[model samples]
Target: MKACNERRVCVTGATGYIGSWLVRSLLQQGYHVHATARDPGKAQRMLSTIEGIDRLQIFRADLNEDRSFDEALKGCVGLFHVAALMEFGTSVQENDHVRRNILEPAVWGTRNLLQSCMRSGTVKRVVFTSSISTITAKDEKGDWKPVVDESSVTPASLVWKTKNPGWVYVLSKLVTEEEAFKFAKENGIDLVSIIPPTVAGSFLTPTVPSSLQVLLSPVTGDPKLYPVLVSVHSRLGSIALVHIEDICRAHIFLFETSRAAGRYLCSAGSCTLPQIMDIVSLELPNWISKSSKVEFNRSAPSIISSKRLLDLGYRFKYDAKDVIKESIQSSIGNGFLNSQVEFKV
Candidate 1:
């Protein structure tokens, strides 16, 4: 439980949605930050989101390139490994392409980064941003376990056999986290992995993240896209939701707290997709018309517990309703969504 403000820290994917916010938080806490971006020119645009630019150093590092992060890791006491390959439109037919693009980069990029950290000999702790997909592949029906925690994990063999794009992405995360833990253990690095559910909040970057894009699909009146949204809702059942800011705080908490170990599940609560649609409709009723068919599965929803984080005395600042409202407001402010109707929660 020592103050990390005296040490220098590095954040990979520093311009990304969650990563950008994390950089802002760390700078505000008076930490000297070494941030990495694949393209320094493009990353400059997002630099305005974080203050104290004088204390921030930017490095050019690509996750796919081995040893690209060596300079960034130099003299850093902590590392936040948040970069991952996430292609939104991967087809089942492109199995090999998916493996090469998404799976390999996620696993190998983590290995390369950890190797650099170990070589530098300055890194004492690593906070990895992992997904809840590693815990559960997909929602199941008919008398199954209704809760998922840190102990829950999807088997790699089972995920590989399905050959589904979504499952493949899950497998990539599973491998990355598992490999990261193994490397950290052997190298004596203090590693804390954060498993977060569907993250929804304001975007710090110019482009909308794939997760937010899916959440905003119903608002875009595309007939072809509506059923896909409905299908996702039916298949996923109840989703564990968390705000981006909360997840960033959880990462910082784990880094600063001495007792924090192993994995922590970060989520505010669970809510059905139809319930989310209802909230959205209240704000933008014109976005979702009465003619749109909303479907819900008649099965019990699964719950994801954040008791470990709670037990560690970390309080969530936003609930499911708050997440939706803030996201809509942010979208409007960012000009991602055009609506004349004012929305107040």
Candidate 2:
């Protein structure tokens, strides 16, 4: 892929958690940003606080609609496809709603956007934001493989067989990613996918992201979100995490690095439930107490290797503890957590 002289790029799903952060980072780095969102009003309101707001242009686009992203992709040499229909526990049974609403739209949206990319003669490289849900490898007997990496792929049939809404979302990611790779290969569009595990830390979105809700479930004791955390551990054997900043940086890094190709696993680190709880006790003592009722899965954690990204000389700015602290602090600052909670500092 050739690099463009002008620093202009388009980011879809620009109002979402990671997308919003990426827009800020790119603008800070002197890139003219064309950001796409469903509602231009919400996009303008959400992104109004960035320092380089004048350099950012908001375009209305729908992932489910063909050619919706064309206006945003114009004159941009790079595209970051960050939009997706994220649903968890939507319906008890995985039926047509799951397929029509969640799965098919994700795949179709990817195709439609890439087709627009192909038509936009200026687009040289595309960076796709993917999730860890696509990496839960299992054997024929339904046991997790010893280690999960970029090559690990979750079977669509297995996800469908469970009839779980979360797993159904997982299936959507897997299928969409597969479709993206295939289209990129056939169309000669240089593409790189950054697969991040549970993302945490400071967020730009007004409401707390779903990932944060699941991350802090131990403190909130939220019945709905706690099960999602349990499901992650039960499927992946460990809770892998990445700071929101690091994941966004990786997306920019891969997009700029001409040699970067294929899938890159972008987790900063993994921490057990006890380890996370210990950090909470030390950093935000009043948030979670010693007597907090919590149960953890005893499964041996599987390793997620980031050797490829590390080999590229990328360093993680925050470890697991730092990520946890930032997430808690952001939650408190944003009113997701009780503002009365005491901090160590």
Which candidate ranks first by lDDT, i.e. highest?
2
Query: lDDT tens digits, residues 226-257, model 2?
Result: 77777776677767899998999899999988
C-alpha positional error of residue 169 in candidate 2 after TM-score superposition, expressed in Å: 1.8
- lDDT scores of the candidates, listed in order: 0.76, 0.83
Q: What lDDT does model 1 reach?
A: 0.76
RMSD in angstroms, candidate 2? Answer: 3.1
Residue-pair clash count for candidate 2: 0
Candidate 1 lowest-lDDT run of ten: 136-145
lDDT per residue (tens digit) for residues 1-345 in model 1 = 322334699999987888888888888888889989998776777885567888888899997788899888888889998887555345555667767867777778888999998877778889998987776624343233567688877667766776444566677789899999998899788999998877788867887666666566666544443444444444346666789889888989999888999999998986676677778888776663432666664433666789999999999999978887888878778777774233343
Off by over 4 Å in 2: 1-5, 142-146, 287-300, 339-345
Give the Å shift of residue 154 in candidate 2.
1.4
